[model samples]
Target: MDLVERLFAGDKRACARLISHVENNVNGVNEDLKKIYKETGKAYVIGITGPPGSGKSTLTDKLVKLLRKEDKKIGIIAVDPTSPFTGGAILGDRVRMGDLNTDSGVFIRSMGARGHLGGLSDATSAAVTVLDAYGCEYIFLETVGVGQSEVEVMKSADTTLMVMVPGLGDDIQAIKAGVMEIGNVFAVNKSDRDGAKRTKREIDMMLDFSKKDWRPSVTLVSAIKDENVDVLLEKIFEHRDYLLESNLYHLERKANVKNEILSLVRKEIMERVINNDEKHQLLEDLSHKVALRIENPYTASEIIINELKK
Candidate 1:
């Protein structure tokens, strides 16, 4: 049987292989995806994002363990920082979450961010689709510790959980700058650490100024000690329910599909028009012209685009 059929037949290896293909942008993968795309949207996508050393992996592990008690099928996509030399994931999460491999109900995959901005790899949404189609009830996307500009998870996930630990002074600034806008729920992980209550109060105070249809919930949880983890999970579920009840679920899904289509169109144009072998020399000549001040890049780009259109 083919990969899609195998995936539909409950084959983990097929799922892994298909995700790999999507990540690498392998030829004909889009066709494979089309075959299985209908099976998606069953899984609830949760995006987990925060700073480096925030124990997101550990928190994810704890959350998965709790969910598995109810026999839920879970998929984890850990967007690890790319290795400079190999251009592949550093695989830190794989090491931290290795024990979860014993559970057939849990599937973990680590994807290299590969310098893609917005804390997630370009293939992340597609990989999520693959897992969602594979019958996962919940999918956790752990981003590569992001900053002010990396708030794309809000667009991709049904719920966005921002994980922060106490003692990071910079995070206080980060929250005020833009994270406060994207996060659906705030988690003060490693609550055993000093200033945990202070951090929670700071968030609560900051949240007081903002008004929305659904207020974001802030919770302190010590993942290592398993303190309040269940509460945090429930908060996430509450956010999901709010989206569904408010009719934002359908709207958000519409926006997500629009973004995905636009992204794919841009990618296709970039590959077929600008990166074509026939255009390579033209691009180089335009670059030289621009470097010599004989032509500005705007006009050069227009020239390339017009030429391609003809």
Candidate 2:
């Protein structure tokens, strides 16, 4: 049987192989994705994001353990920062989640960010698609703790959890508007630490300014100690149920698809510009003109677009 067929049959090796192809941009990977696309959209995607040292990996590990108790088949995609020299994942999140490695019900893969500033690898959505098609009931997408701009999780997750820890001075101020807006649930990880209450209060104060119909919940939990993680899990389900009951699930899925399409289009256009000799020359010429102040960026972009049209 082919990879997609094996994947559909719950072959873990097939799932890992397909994700590897997607990450490396191997030839025909997109076509492979097309074959399995119809089987996706069944899994519930949960995104965990926060700044470095926030214990996101530990939180994810604990959450997976809890999910296992419910007989939930899980797929975890942990995005880690790429090493500048080796071009590989620097901090292997999989190492932190080592306990799940032996569990057949849980499939975990770590991906290098590879310079993607969004805190996720470019292949993240596709990897999620593969897992979704593989019949995973719950898919956890853990981002490389790359601060604020990591809000790209909103484009892929049904429920986005903003993980924060105490003792990070001015934590509220450190969270950007983009990050604040994307959170469906807030988790104060390492709640045993000093100032955990103050952190929760600060988040509460900021959330009060919002007038959304569904207010995001802030739960304090010590991921390392596995304390109150069940409460956090309940909150996650509550958010998921809200999406389904409010008829917002399909709406969010549509938006997620739109974002994925736009991202693919942008990547393809960039690759085209860089690979075509004539276009590459035109880009360099335009860059030189911009450097000399002979042409502004808007006009240069227009010229490039015109060239692309031809």
Candidate 3:
């Protein structure tokens, strides 16, 4: 049997291999994914995003443990910062969740941000797609924790959880309009620290005026101490239940599907334009004109696009 068949047969090694192929951009991997794409849209994606040092990883670990209690298969895609020199993730996957390796129910993958502005890497959606086809019931996408721009997580997640800590007033203010509005559940982690209530109050105040039909719940929890974590999980479930009951799940899924499709189309077009050998010299000429300000970029782009039509 081939890799996709192995994946359908519940082979963990095959599942890991497929994710690796996606991450590394192996040849024909896109074809492999096409064979399994129909099996996707089954797993519920939860996006966890926040600023650096917010203990988002710990919170995810706790949540997975809770999920394991119910015998649910879980997939975690943790996107960490990339090292400028090495262009690899600064944090290792095993180091982040050493204990979870023994559990067959959990699959963890650490990916580099690769300078993607939205906190997730280019391969994230693909990795999630593989895991979904691999039969994971829940997929956790932990972002690189870049502030403000992390709102992109909402596009891929069925429900997004914005993590906060007791401090970092500036970070909170910066993301208020961005990730703040996108989160379906707000988790004020490290609640044992001072100002926990103050932080929760701030989120509550914002949600009040936002008046979203699904009001994002803000919960104070200490992941290290395991305090209020169960409650946090409950709030997450509540948000998921709300989406399901209100029939927003299917509607949101439609939007997400459309968004992913459009994004893939744009990416494919760009790749084709840039990688075309015949247009290489033309691109250089256009760049030179645009650089010298002899020709505006709009016209140069139009010229290349017209070539594509030909």
- TM-scores of the models, in the given order? 0.96, 0.94, 0.95
lDDT of 2 at 187: 95
- lDDT tens digits by residue: candidate 1, 115-219: 787889899989999999899999999998876568888778888999988887743574576765788899999898999888888887777777777788899
- For model 2, the stretches where C-alpha displacement exceeds 4 angstroms are 84-86, 171-176
Model 2 error, position 282 (Å): 2.2
User: In model 3, which runs have C-alpha deviations exceeding 4 angstroms?
Assistant: 84-86, 170-175
CA error at residue 30 for candidate 3, angstroms: 2.0
Error of 3 at 10 (Å): 1.6
How should the candidates be ordered by lDDT, best one leading? 2, 1, 3
How would you encode candidate 2's per-residue C-alpha lDDT over 1-310 as one tens digit per residue? 9998899889989999999999999989999999999878899999999888798889999999999999999999998889878785565788778899999999998888898888788999999999999889999999988655668988899999999888776855744477767889999998988999889988887887888888899999999999999999999999999999998999989999999999999999998899899999999999999999999999999988898888
Any idea what lDDT model 1 has? 0.87
Worst 10 residues of 1 by lDDT: 170-179
157 Cα displacement, candidate 2 (Å): 0.4
Candidate 2: clashing pairs of residues? none
All-Cα superposition RMSD per candidate? 1.6, 1.8, 1.7
